[model samples]
Target: MKDTTIDDISLISIPKIKEVRGNLGVIEGDVIPFEIKRVYYLYDVPSDAQRGGHAHKELYQFLIPLSGSFDIKLHDGINKKTIHLNKPDKGLLLVPGIWREMDNFSSGAVCLVLASQKFNEADYIRDFKTFKSFKR
Candidate 1:
């Protein structure tokens, strides 16, 4: 029984070229079609700790689970959806005005995130209550 608020989240599967012993995953312009300006990863997290408890005001993000699995709870001010990221060849496309939280991450999970813009504190809506108000 988990409680989530956002709903527009979906699993995005990227194209993968397979080989004999190795596989290559690519996110081309035709694949994602968004200008990825920022790239980052989340790692070295404690077992009971949770990450990503904020909402972006204008930043669109693509989230990929490079290793292990995790649950992405997304809220679009009205509806809610929980997206699970476990495969490296897929990612989650999160649009702006969506409140998101990442939790239930397995041990040694690596989350790769791609953003449409650089770091900006004004672009993030940290307070959940304020996010709700802005949702309208």
Candidate 2:
């Protein structure tokens, strides 16, 4: 796998259609850099709770705020950056080998995630030290 940097992360704009009832945002497989194999959403999280303190070996993820706002802290083993996901029409594209942590969730925040791979515990590097060594 290629070493991913902070620059590799991007904000993708999904097509949104405005209507009288409500707005609709569409996301297709080709809209992102990778194919979608799994989909999940996080909701009803406590204000003090955090999520995702690990790095993936090959998985790719696209994250969006389906409801409220939250912040994602990303580290490429050398550089760190924080990205906020607050809009329903925008999504964050995350590549492999990057450590990430999500926090600062607003009330009723719903985080929708599109993943390129299925659930596999072996693909995850939960240790920060192991992730740094893997980047080297």
Candidate 3:
């Protein structure tokens, strides 16, 4: 597994075009670090609820908050960081091998995740212990 750190994470700004009707944000394949293969979103989370308590072995992800706000706690076995997501035109880029936990979700917060790979159960490391071992 790769040794990831907070430095590897970046806040990407999506292109926004302002119009009289409304504003639009565009995300193209070349805009991000990796090509997106899967797309998913989390919504309807309770204020006290949390999500994403796992690490990926090879998959990369980009997280964006479509509405409200939330915090994503990332641990790379050696370092940890907390990132807040609230803007629709910004996203958090998460590299592989970093364990992550999403929490502090406000009511009606919608988190959109763009993945570099398709869903594979084996790619997930759900246990902190196992994820730490992979870091070593």
For each candidate, give its TM-score against the true structure.
0.90, 0.96, 0.96
TM-score of 2: 0.96
| Candidate 3 weakest lDDT stretch, 10 residues | 1-10
lDDT of each residue in 10-79, candidate 1, tens digit only:
5678889999988889898666647999999998666577788888877878999999988887777777
Clash count for each candidate, listed in order shown: 6, 0, 0
Superposed model 1: Cα runs more than 4 Å off: 1-8
The models' CA-based lDDT, in order, is 0.81, 0.93, 0.91
Q: Pick the candidate with the highest TM-score.
A: 2
Q: Give the TM-score ranking, best first.
A: 2, 3, 1
lDDT of 1 at 48: 73
lDDT of 2 by residue, 3-120 (tens): 8898999999999889999998988757898888999999998878899999999999999999999999999999999998999999999999999999999999999999999999
Instruction: Write down the lDDT that model 2 would get.
Output: 0.93
Quick one: ranking by lDDT, best first? 2, 3, 1
- CA shift of 110, model 2, Å: 0.4
Q: Tens-digit lDDT track for model 3 on 32-136?
A: 988889999999988888798999999999999999999999999889999999999999999989999999999889999999999999999999999989989
